[model samples]
Target: MAPQLTSLYTTSFLIALFVTLLVAACLRAINILPGRTCHSAKAPRKAAPATRILIVLGSGGHTHEMFHLLRDLDTSRYTQRTYIVSGGDAFSAQRAVEFEQTLEDRASETRNKATTVRRRGTERPLCVGAEHFNIATIPRARKIHQSLLTTPFTSLVTLVSAFSPLFRSDRLHPNLPPTTPYEIAAQDLPDLIITNGPATGVIVVLAALIAKFFNLKGCSSRSKCRTIYVESFARVKTLSLSAKLLAGVVDRFLVQWEELEGEGGYVGGHAEYWGILV
Candidate 1:
């Protein structure tokens, strides 16, 4: 009886091994295995049609990282568009002109080397004015302070009135326009990628909501809509809790800080640790 039991166990082990080999062989035959996705596990897959990629970045090292990604994008599969909306020297009109020229030069070099011609350009995004304040201008600041001190309610009323047109919660509201940042960006874009800044993330979220509103599923207009958030812990750590919450809505989260690269703060579970861009 013992001999028979040992033989049975050996037979079961052999059968399981054969089944595993057979399943692996079948997967390899159909090119469903990881190594077979690309030819010989080393060669790259055939490039997909050009995708529309939007890089929404604040002006700083984060912006610099997006520029590097723009330069390296597989032109055969991606065309990059950039939107600048953050406040800094980089977001100023002068910097916008300089950055535009630099991006154009990079795009030209990329297009010359590949069959996929990239149609790239920059957009100066519209401001929501939610957090707009002018502290640098002393006269305006003094006036605002005087108003606040004299009549707090009046100041509050004035501020709300000033920003009334910018904030809309409902899609069907008559004041809200159907044309959103995503719709506007995706009009000529196949894929959209946004990086840095909570404001840019807001633009992407608005775009995705607009895409769903139009029912653009499965089409090119819907197919390439993707937002990649290039995150820096330095930046994330600096933001208020509400701003961090807002940043969580992006599609892909890529980290730049090497020491604190894993999922934390705003990124949560969907974060990818890319270490440093440079």
Candidate 2:
């Protein structure tokens, strides 16, 4: 009697297992799987819209270097905007203006061409690389951590003057002292902010702080802008404490030549002599 009862229980368990499998197969056929097991035969989903991208460039060769990367950004996936912050004397303000203008012109031309093509009924898709790259110039503002006796009053005053111009975008009032650089940047916030190294680092820091404040106030999204430091002096094996700390905050870091790793160095856990620009 005991053997017979055990056999009956084993049969019931097997029947339950078979029923579960049958149900799963039926659900799959009907495309009603509860989880992610449903596999579509179509292509993968397209990337999210790149409505905004902020590119911050410091004075000197760094600006030129960052531009190279900016040029490569998949316009289909990004709307490139620019911010110019001079930290060093490598490029004069005039030169920076020229660079900024060149970028704007390129963006405009691309947009016009896309519109024209669409009007022509072309099959190619038009990618809006940068909806707007609002260019803002940020003057230098030194960061001074509060010490036992030192106050940040002076720094606060400096920032106020720098950011004051953000309020006056229509026209530089004749009264303002030639308009501080920070005022220009404050004119508008960005979706993503990118910065190169050396001079513009301070401006990047300030921009981040401002973004954080706006986010805390619930007006903007948490800092979606990314800062990219390319071929920075900090890339050297030894870096100042402050520089090291700054590196930690930057979103992505790129080095042209790795002296220790030499050409074909290992970066991003990938091996290549020449740094892949992406």
Model 2 over residues 198-238: C-alpha lDDT tens digits? Answer: 43454455645554444532213433443444544334453
Give TM per candidate: 0.44, 0.47
> What is the Cα-based TM-score of model 1?
0.44
Question: Residue by residue across 1-278, what tens digits does model 1's lDDT show?
Answer: 35755665687788998999999765543332112112123434554333345444544555565556555444333432334333343343344345556645665665475447544454232221111111110001113235546554543343333221112121223454446543233234335545554433444444453443343443223344455566644653344332355345544556665443444333244445565653
How far out, in Å, is residue 113 in model 2? 8.5
Question: Lowest-lDDT window of 10 residues in candidate 2?
Answer: 263-272
Best by TM-score: 2
Compared with the true structure, the alpha-carbon lDDT of candidate 1 equals 0.42
Off by over 4 Å in 2: 1-50, 73-77, 86-97, 100-131, 142-189, 206-210, 217-223, 233-243, 259-278
